[model samples]
Target chain A: MHLNYYQKEDQVLLAVDCIIFGFDKENLKILLIKRNFEPEKGKWSLIGGFLKKNENLDEAAVRVLETLTGLNDIYLEQIHTYSKIDRDPGQRTISVAYFALIDVDSHHFDGIQIDAAHWFDIKEAPNLIFDHNEMVQKAKARLKRRALSKPIGFELLPEKFTMRQLQNLYESILDKKLDKRNFINKINSLDVLIKLDEKDMSVSRKGAYLYVFDKDKYEKKVEEDGFIFKI
Target chain B: MHLNYYQKEDQVLLAVDCIIFGFDKENLKILLIKRNFEPEKGKWSLIGGFLKKNENLDEAAVRVLETLTGLNDIYLEQIHTYSKIDRDPGQRTISVAYFALIDVDSHHFDGIQIDAAHWFDIKEAPNLIFDHNEMVQKAKARLKRRALSKPIGFELLPEKFTMRQLQNLYESILDKKLDKRNFINKINSLDVLIKLDEKDMSVSRKGAYLYVFDKDKYEKKVEEDGFIFKI
Candidate 1:
């Protein structure tokens, strides 16, 4: 194919922005970075970078996340694309936004990069640079919708978690207090968890039973009946 | 800002392809045009064009659709962006795929363009150029999911339609047989429809009551409580 066919078309910059979501014991937080480059020099912003010539958007997103967080093989989903004419003041660049879920305690943050990156509670995150705040809001909404039908919430939890911990994670993400009995009932109906023999003794004297997500069973159920994990 | 800042980066060609969906009485169809340009000339393909320098991706998609259908303000949604390195054979181009829903009986088709553009039942659509077949599959899946939670199915129907026509639209898009009684029960529970005294006798001897989607009521209900219209 002749390159001249596309020569007349305008070539624009493409960037990828990552909305890193983390869940601690009490809050849902987002990983934000302080911009150290021109155009937004000192403002808070999403961890982002321009797409390279040899890489696709997903690879660019993964590279950006790995460069900042020192994490690999994390849960990442493409949520939306932002393409306003002046979204980026530096140029007319289009950005693909990805939402990533990582356990708050699992990743190792580079000390130098850690100085610029911080996990802020979702509600407390400051106004971000350019259209990044809008990107974060869209990612959060996608996360909320996805959590209702998929077992992706497990990506935010540790390998072994207590029932109360699971409920707290949902309540934090959904931003609503759920009835304990009702929540438990709905989760049990999904039948995608393995109740372990051990118990977590840190939160209470009696201890709540620990449960782990049963991936095999979930896949089987999904294949059998198009199962929807609703809470 | 100096253009030299991004001059070293490899600029890529961006294109937008529209999956135009239309619903007839008994089938769901997609509009595909025969490509008249090189690198797959004369092959059936989705209506597509490269993004110009001054235009956003959405604008490009609308331009492509309007050029063929001469319709504006249709229900167009950005479904996904395909950026595989070799998905397009002609060049390293990233295509944003949009799914548009149009009332088949409402839009006017230009006679000259109609000679090259044809509507094919989605299931019977010819092998499309590039990865457009895959794009259609992805858009169809999204349309199925969106129809269940949102009232977007109305976009494929006329302003006034009968309950039977509505159920048929859902069945065709879902590619399944639905229990009529159960479908009506679910739609009525949502309480977002106005049953009119008028009747449509075209499909049956006795005529079914016509209904119109109540956009205002639906929005109000959505605001009051997080409404999930499950079928």
Candidate 2:
């Protein structure tokens, strides 16, 4: 399989950029890392690294995550790729954007090289480097769509979360007010959650019951009849 | 501006692949071309070409679509990139998949060369080359989601379409048997359609009224208040 026909085509640098989405109490935050390289040195940029040899985009994303956060084994999905000729001013590079949702407190960070990684409130994010702001916008759109159609939002929040936290997470991502009753009705109709005999009273006087996604039951039901989790 | 640090990294081939979706009457079809190149010659493949020096990914997608359809100015969007190590059995190449919607009868076939290009009924599409089938599935999923949340479905269908045709298109894409009365009620409630007096008598004796999406009105109303067109 010779496959050398495209060898002479303009070979441009490729980057794997990650948008780490995390949820804190009420607001959604995006992780930004200070660029250590010369092109955008010290400027706030997405957590990114050049795709290394022998690594595919997913592995590259995981490597980027591990390099920045000192953590692995997270949910990362390739959202879209940005390849405008001038997206990166320093060179003609194509960047494949991935969105990763990790529970904020789950991954530990040692006091070392990973200090540059910090979570910023999505609305208050600093001026980003290159076309990263556009990437964030696109990632947010994908997150919103995924949140509505699937149960992936649970990945961003804590494993055991109250119903209010879930609702707030949706509202933060969607930037719209959702009726509590209507939201609960819609979510409950999906029949994919398991109510644990636990309550979290941190945010309210009357504690809310905690729930965890029943993965096995959900997977079975999803296979039997597509359990659409409409938001 | 010295990118010398990355000069030694693996410079793999990059290509833009397109899933051209077209709607004929009520059938949702995708335009696919047979591969005539070495690695997978004479097999069913996606419409694709390698990224050029001066062109971006979107530009490459447009170029590939124009080259295949012999026409320019089509609606195309970058869905996701496939970067699995063995996705392309011939070599380790990264492919950015773009999904496009084109009017069925509007493309020009002049000056286009390669293996045969034809529309495929999505469900019955043959075994494609490499991971092309997965790309098609993702594109169809995006199309269905977009159809429900935006006015993209109208791009695939003709300017004027009967309610039954539109409903059938939705049914075909979503792979569900929707109740006719409920489907009509939901679409009518959207208030973005202009119902003409013409009836489509081709499909039935009673016929259905012809309607075209009022672009200006739909744009205006969607801006003022979000719309959800569902079946």
Which one wins on DockQ? 1
C-alpha lDDT of residue B94 in model 1? 88
Candidate 2 A-chain TM?
0.89
- Per-model DockQ against the true two-chain complex: 0.44, 0.42
Please write out the lDDT profile of model 1 over residues A1-231, one tens digit for every residue.
Answer: 546686767787888899999987567999998987678788999998888878889999989888876778887888778888889887788888898998897677873467799999998999999989888888888877666655555778889898888888888878889899999998888788999999989879998899999989766654442335455
The TM-score leader among the candidates is 1
Which candidate tops lDDT?
1
* Runs with alpha carbons beyond 4 Å of true place in candidate 1: A220-231, B1-4, B111-113, B219-231
TM-score for each candidate, following the candidate numbering: 0.93, 0.88
Candidate 2 chain B lowest-lDDT run of ten: B221-230
In candidate 1, residue A222 scores what lDDT?
Answer: 44
Model 2, TM vs. native: 0.88
lDDT of 1 by residue, B1-231 (tens): 545565655677889999999987667899999987778889999988888877788999888788776777887889888888888777788889998998888888863356789889888999999999999999988888666656655678889988888888888777888998999998888788999999998878989899999989776654542345555
Each candidate: RMSD to true structure? 2.3, 3.2
